[model samples]
Target: LWGIPLLHTEGDERTDVILGKFLKARDFKVSQALAMLKNCVLWRKSFKADEILDEELGADFDGMAFMFGEDKEGHPVCYNVFGVLQDKDLYSKVFGDDAARFLRWRVQLQEKGVKMLKLEPSTPNALLQVIDLKNAPWPAKKVRSVLLKAISLLQDNYPELVIKNVFINVPWYYSAVFSLLSPFLTQHQKNKFVVTRLGKSTEALFKLISPEKVPIQYGGLGRAGDDEFSGADAPVTELPIKAGEKKTVELAVTTGGSSITWDLVVVGSEVSYGAEFQPDQEGGYTTIIEKTKKISAQLEEPIRNSFKASEPGKVVLSIDNSLSKKKKSVVYRHIVKAA
Candidate 1:
């Protein structure tokens, strides 16, 4: 009979007593049973089973506990747990009858925006057969081999769902299967599913599987420092361009009583810009010429004042349509003489 609680803790004397009685009845080594009990406690804490199940099932209970119950003769037996289900029929449907109801519940939860579920690996072989019917890509021989290993591991973990088979090989398919099942799995269970691929393919697979759930920081272009300065009343402005279109803008580098060096940086979706400089006859001033191959808005010139020019003078900059087949150019000029 099933007598395992849905959850357990390290200091629970009742649990220790239960474990001792179970081991003694089976004539099993108490030390081994104690070790298994320790493992179970660690697993429960790591998975936060009580909180996770509560959130997933939307129920209030002290906690769930699991245990490996035994018969009067003290032999290792199947697993069992304690929990109250509102829909007994639904519960039986999901856990019983080859998990037919369970799979359907998965689909239904997906439709309702639920995104993950967990099930014990020993769950009726019929249920595994059904899951295989839907997502198994390997040959029958390979599926059986992998499933047995997975189920064995699941049994060791007892109430925890087994997910190793999902990642054994063919990560793309595994991710796909998990993504499809995400709506039915709990957050903790969903975390158990891992994608083993690396690099671009893995990125693409993740994007394909959970585009909406992907973190925002991973996508999108970053803004340039020049844009922030220009917007803050700096003496520079960004020129706009269209795809294949070119434009030039002027920049003002104020000496502000000291000589400073400046750099021009172009910011565009897909455009490149270059700059050339010419010095004045007095050797105290210089002009910077800037050019762009296509049209786009970019911040150019981090102005640094160096060597006061003493008199009013002008610096010329230009941008050319390098990206266009027809070949056109645009120019911008800035004057940074005294004031």
Candidate 2:
């Protein structure tokens, strides 16, 4: 459907891949897959799906959904934040008596995500869907109905386009809502869903995405503004701290006139953190880069800091979790630049 011929006679890998998607979605049933293909083509022509990309859906929906970094398998990650609908004005606008506009905008986002897929026989042809349900108005009947309709439309027409539907920051009562949705979902679809409760999304996300690719808001090292490192920076290393324990990461400054930058995140709870530069020379002084401070559990952003070395020394980052009964995971990365 996405610019590839679906006929069996085409004999091309792209066409076979397109046909395989529908077949897999319908449990390899040829008749049902063919019927789905026909219906999708018809629906696309009627809904002008091909032309939706050119339409400006407005800035109001900008943060509602967005394409972010890729997953471990190189599939593009699409984040859908339903929390935006907590705004009364936005809630009424998108989920009011008419959901057509909202549906169109949502479909348009899916179309954009689909474009990220390579759709070849070997490459990753699906997007990872992360739906943030934090602060969402789940009790609203109108919003629920519109969400269901959008989900149905996407699942029907965009079969096999998503690797997983991860619902993060889900409330306690979400299980009840999921029970209702289960009837409409196939076993295959059900298996693709992943749900995480409040405060645990960061841990869940890290298992699927790299620390640098994950946004800092979800407890990873990825930050948006004036970042010292980019996507090409060194990979993040993980450190485990047992309850009532301490750990230090040391970065060696082998030469003088060098600069070191680092980012670190402590998942789950508050901890005491500090940094210092220890010189290698005998009887040399130690410089405190960051004062030992009690980082709060509520801190949503990762720690980023830098230091310039005038002489040979090592930058040591210390994390203390003695006050916490639970073990903690630390994710961090560092870069050293020579002058």
Candidate 3:
């Protein structure tokens, strides 16, 4: 049980004097009250004896500590800290001086599917009471060397098991050393040693496991959204067609700035087509096929067919420059049928 003193604006002790006696009469232990005072000291570092009790204690007490007081701004504040006691002998067996024993128990816990382990700096004494726990020497320069020896011994004896060291709160200087040891670590080791502090920079360090890998598509020159396809050489243009038309037999050429001559071509095995047009500066030229005249009905029939009826066919559309004779063209291919 725990207790703390409450205070009012006046800081008067008599404000709850009657209530204090009723609380004490209810069998609240004095030692418990003192423990609450100790907790207040730990949190705030200072408190008046009278104000401490008035601001903190309550009638129903549990085995915990409490705090009492106001901040420098006079805002009321109070809180409680609870403690749990565990068995002592259990501690020694789990985290004792023998690193081998600790490693074994850690493996057992992981096999049971534990996700995380938490240790409190404040609760070390309680933990030590159950297990023969001991801290590794401080300022140790060769911690990895020692850990590697332990890992080798485990692997040699338990052929089916591998151990990995996972360090939490790693200071910045040791990150490079961790990278050096990564290649030697096994699959189980990699799974166990997750660096929690990677944050935004994690993408640069971590390698993708098989299940997480994905394939990427490659795009070529003069593609949409490409920066290199800018300027007069590749002017913005659109190709318009009817909803059901499979292809457009005619081609239109438009250019900005200086005069230029361009070549339009359709490259395919069954049918190949080409045309040349010269447009003056800021001018354009249109080449109409007059579908009824230029293209034969048999060829135009296939071009007008929908993808549903065409099981398999390939067609490439290209446009280039003829003035400089450069192959600065946009090429696109479409497969009408699944291969």
Query: How many clashing residue pairs appear in each of the predictions shown?
Result: 36, 0, 19
Candidate 3: count of backbone clashes, pairs at least 3 residues apart or interchain: 19
lDDT of all predictions: 0.33, 0.87, 0.28
Give candidate 1 misplaced runs (Cα > 4 Å): 1-239, 254-272, 276-286, 289-317, 325-339
Candidate with top TM-score is 2
Model 2's alpha-carbon lDDT is 0.87
Ranking by lDDT: 2, 1, 3
Q: How well does model 3 score by local distance difference test?
A: 0.28
Better of 1 and 2 by lDDT: 2
Q: Residues 1-339, candidate 3, lDDT per residue (tens digit)? A: 012234555554432442332233223566654454345345333323223323423222221112122222222212111111132333333234544444443333222221111111221110000010012122134445544554454332222221222232334555665666677665544564544331211121112111011000101111224332234343322232222223332222232222222222111112223332333324444332212212211221112111221111112232222222212212222212212
Higher-scoring candidate on TM-score, 1 or 2: 2
- Cα displacement (angstroms), candidate 1, residue 278, comes to 8.2
State every prediction's TM-score relative to the real structure. Answer: 0.24, 0.96, 0.19
